[model samples]
Target: MYWFLLLMAGVFESAFAIGLKLSDGFSKPVPSLLTAIAIALSMLMMSLAMRGIPVATAYAVWVGIGVAGSLTLSYLFLKEPINSMQLISVALILFGVLGLKVTSTG
Candidate 1:
């Protein structure tokens, strides 16, 4: 259940990030509302996950997932640059997140 919640939180983190960009600096009302909702839901899910997950671990994973997802979305949808260096960096972040979970027995 905790892992499930954390994954959901990560997805919402991605959603909110895309929403933020779509909001166009919050000048668009619909996207702004979506951004608010996505951020709220992400936080809620993270809080729920925290009941069973350590703070540092969960946070690192959450941010890692967010950074990867958001950057990928930007590349695909927004036509942003996705150079090899950036891709490698995001992959490293994912590996680090997994490493944190795998290395810790606590």
Candidate 2:
């Protein structure tokens, strides 16, 4: 359950990023409101996840998910280009997150 919350937090973080982009420096009211809500929800979910997960592991995993999710979403919807090197870097980050999950006590 905590892991699921962590995943949701990461997804929200991705949405926050996308929302921020769409918000245009908060000039667009609806997107700005969504960005604020996404960040709040992300933090809330991450805090919930920390109840059962080690802070270090949870944080790293959250960031990993956020980075990957944001990149994928940007590529698909925002037409952002991704390169091979960036993919390899993201892969390494994911492996590190996996290792942390495997080794963490909480």
Candidate 3:
């Protein structure tokens, strides 16, 4: 359950990061509002996750999700470069996250 919450927090962190770009420096009201909301939700979820998951492990997982999700979003929506290196890095993050999940479950 806490891991799930951690994942959701990561997703929200990604959302708000993308939302920040979409908001164009908060010039656009709707996207900016979404960015704010998403950020708040991410923090809330991460705090909840910390209750069960070790702080170090949870932070690593959270960062993994944010990095992977944000990169994908940037590639697909923002026309950012998506090269082999980028994909490989994302995969590495996934592996690390999975390792944390598996090993920490005990």
lDDT of 2 by residue, 12-85 (tens): 99999999999999999999999999999999999999999989899999999999989999999899999999
Q: Could you tell me the TM-score of candidate 1?
A: 0.93
Candidate 1: which stretches are off by over 4 Å? none
Which pairs of residues have clashing backbones in candidate 1?
none
How big is the positional error of residue 90 in model 2, measured in Å on the Cα after superposition?
A: 0.7
Q: In model 2, which runs have C-alpha deviations exceeding 4 angstroms? A: none
Flag the better candidate by lDDT, 1 or 2.
2
The alpha-carbon lDDT assigned to residue 21 of candidate 2 equals 93
Reference-based lDDT, residue 35, model 3: 97
Model 3 misplacement above 4 A: none
lDDT of each: 0.90, 0.94, 0.94
For 24-79, candidate 1 gives per-residue lDDT tens digits of: 99999999999999999999999998888899988998899899999988888989
